[model samples]
Target: MVDVTYNSDLHFEHTLWTSELTFWGGELKSLENRLNELISHWTDKEVLTKLEHYLDEFNLQSNIVRDIQKSIQQHEINILDHTPNGSESMDIPRVKEHLKLRHKMEAQREIYGNLKKDFFLFSSENL
Candidate 1:
């Protein structure tokens, strides 16, 4: 009973995380488009260089989002596999894996948030 409750809670958390990642993916796309629009209005060498940097960072973050989403999906599958009957004991390793995923998601959010702030500042000044 306790194990089933634990698994249910963890599964729900993963579903939420998946939705958040999808939203981040969309935000990155929108930001990329804004960056592309800025490219036409700027011709300074340094500005172009900074734009390139932001684009690269956005690409990297997009990749990270996809990778984390995949990991979450796989982890969910592992959880389901371990609890096929819903009466089995909780998988400690899966719990640990979830914690690791949570950490990665936190770090990704912080890094991406800083990048967005920097990019917005740059765009505002350069636009």
Candidate 2:
């Protein structure tokens, strides 16, 4: 019973993370397009440099989001495999792996949020 509950909770968490990351992936695409548009208007060396930096950061974040999404999907498969036959035996290593993924997701959210905030500030000041 406890194992079933834990599995359910983990599935729910993964679903939420997957949804949020998908939304963020689309946002990054939009931001990249906007940045490209801004790049055409800015000939100033310093502003151009800053725009390039943001573009790189956005690309990096997008990659991270994709990687994490893959990890989550793989982890879900692992959960299903381990729980086959409705066995009550919980895989300790898998549980630890889920915890690690949860931490990674939380850290990515904070880092990505900061990047967006900084990018917006730069855009506001330079545009």
How well does each candidate superpose onto the true structure, as a TM-score?
A: 0.90, 0.92
Model 2 off-target regions past 4 Å? Answer: 1-5
lDDT of 1: 0.86
TM-score of 1: 0.90
| Candidate 1: tens digits of C-alpha lDDT, residues 40-118 | 7788889988998998899899999999999999988888888758464457787888889989989988998999999
* lDDT at 90, model 2: 50
Residue-by-residue lDDT tens digits, candidate 2, 1-127: 3543478788889999999999999999999999899899989999999999999999999999999999999999998888858664457888899999999999999999999999989888878
- Report how far off residue 114 is in candidate 2 (Å): 0.5
On TM-score, the candidate that comes out on top is 2
The residue pairs in collision within model 1 are none
Total backbone clashes of model 1?
Answer: 0
